[model samples]
Target: MITLISSDKRKFHVLEEVANQSLTIRDVIEDRRGRRRADRIILVTNINSKIPEKVIVYWLRHFLMPEEIAHASMSHKKAEKLKKWEAKFFDTDIDTLNDLILAADSLDIPSLFDGACEKVSDILKNRSAEEVGEISKIENEFTHEEEEEEIPSENAWVWRNEFA
Candidate 1:
């Protein structure tokens, strides 16, 4: 078992495999130095006390118990199920995604950071300026002149083509 300490000093018990998804945790394990506990005491200063709590709790609940996850060599069916479960593990709302990005970035969890950033980028892409603002929860502060300036040309919107 591994202990993960939050910015607010909350501690969570998690499995090593699950917590090692964060590169920060991996480094702690890899370090020959005496600071091995550094991995267990993660200082996610940027994330609020909520997201890490949820993520850590989820890992504990889902993967901590030995009976919860069996090795893939034992059964193909179990392995497939585990794969599917992990695939949807990070699914969340936009605000939660942003929080994940903040937490992951602060923790130096590259995979989580990349995943959250890619999700945000995908959400912003293939969307008009108004749609992007709406998804980001930004009020449409652009004046009429700004709106006019946003559209490159009337034909661009009217035509179908992928620009990059």
Candidate 2:
């Protein structure tokens, strides 16, 4: 078992395999393994307690199975179930989703990072640039002339139809 210390000093006890999903945590564990300490504690300084808590939840949900079982093809039923779970996992408020993305990236958990990115992409798809800017809290700095110059006459129809 490994004890993860959150930025606010919250402690989470998790299985080694589950924590290993985080490459950063795995490296810390590896470096400390030589000491032969019965209990291992790793401090996550980059994220706060709430973010780490959510990350731990994700890690537990995606706990790795045995190598053979993991490599074996999953049945359609299992695949669908996992898909549903992923959808639900990403069904969070925008702020939380952003925090999760940052946490996943910092922890080097590729799947979690990819999932968060895909969720953000799904939200952005089919939306106008203004809508995207609003959702992401970014101010549009392009002037009218710049916008007009950026869209060529040939593609103006396409752009108009897309944003219409």
Candidate 3:
């Protein structure tokens, strides 16, 4: 068993196999092999307690089906079920999704990172430039004149939704 300590000082106990879904955790476990039992405690300083809970749940779900089976010979119904579960899991507020992306990246969980990024893209899709900026909290740094004239004039072929 491995104990993951969250940034908020919460501890999550998980089987080593389940936690191995994270390459970072797997590597840590490998490196500490034959060491004292205390070495099994991993401090996830970058992720908050809530994120660890979510991550553990994700790990447990994925752990149920081995990767070889999931990638090669899983039944169609099982695949569909897993897809639906992933869609629902990622259907969350933008801030939480962003945090999950960060945590997944830091933990080297590629599937989680990609799923969260896809959801974020879906949320941003079909939105106007201003709406996208507002949703992403990006400030418009360009002056009104620069935005309306200079940039468009410099790149005349570039598509401008607002101007269209």
Candidate 4:
């Protein structure tokens, strides 16, 4: 088992295999291989307690798989079940989702990072720039003239009545 320490001093105990899903944690473990598990504590100072707690939950949910099962093609039923679980897992508020994305990126967990990115992309799809900005909590920095000229020119298809 590995003990992960969050920035706020929260401690999470997780299986070494599950924690190794994060390359950063894996590196730490490897570097401390000579030491006992009890002596090894990975301090994730970049992320706060809440974010690391969520990350630990995500890691546990996506725990270790056998090498053969990991590499081989999954059955449709299993695949669909995993898809549903992922959808539900990522069905969080935008702020939490953004935090998850950043945490995943920092931890070097590609699957989580990609999943979060896809979820954010789904929210952005078929939405106007204003809506995207609102959903992503980004202020529209473009001037009115820039919006008028660039939006229609670059996204003419989105401006069409049928598309809208």
**Top model by TM-score, which number?**
3
- What order do candidates take by lDDT, descending? 3, 4, 2, 1
Name the runs in model 3 displaced over 4 angstroms: 154-164
lDDT (Cα atoms) of all candidates against the true structure: 0.67, 0.79, 0.91, 0.81
Which residue pairs show backbone clashes in model 1? none
**Cα displacement (Å) at residue 6, model 4:** 2.4
lDDT of 1 at 89: 60
Worst 10 residues of 2 by lDDT: 62-71
Tell me the TM-score of model 4: 0.81
Model 2 misplacement above 4 A: 36-39, 64-71, 151-164
RMSD of 4: 3.2
Between candidates 2 and 3, name the one with more favorable lDDT: 3
Model 2 TM-score on a 0 to 1 scale: 0.80
Q: Which stretches of candidate 4 lie over 4 Å from their true place?
A: 36-39, 64-71, 154-164
Per-residue lDDT for 1-164 in model 4, tens only? 88878878889888888888898889988888988767777777866788878787778767744325544876778767777888998998888888898888888998899999999888889987678888887897889987889876888875578743
Best by lDDT: 3
* Candidate scoring better on lDDT of 3 and 4: 3
Per-residue lDDT, model 4, residue 152, is 69
Total residue pair clashes for candidate 4: 0
Task: Quote the lDDT for 146 in model 2.
Answer: 69
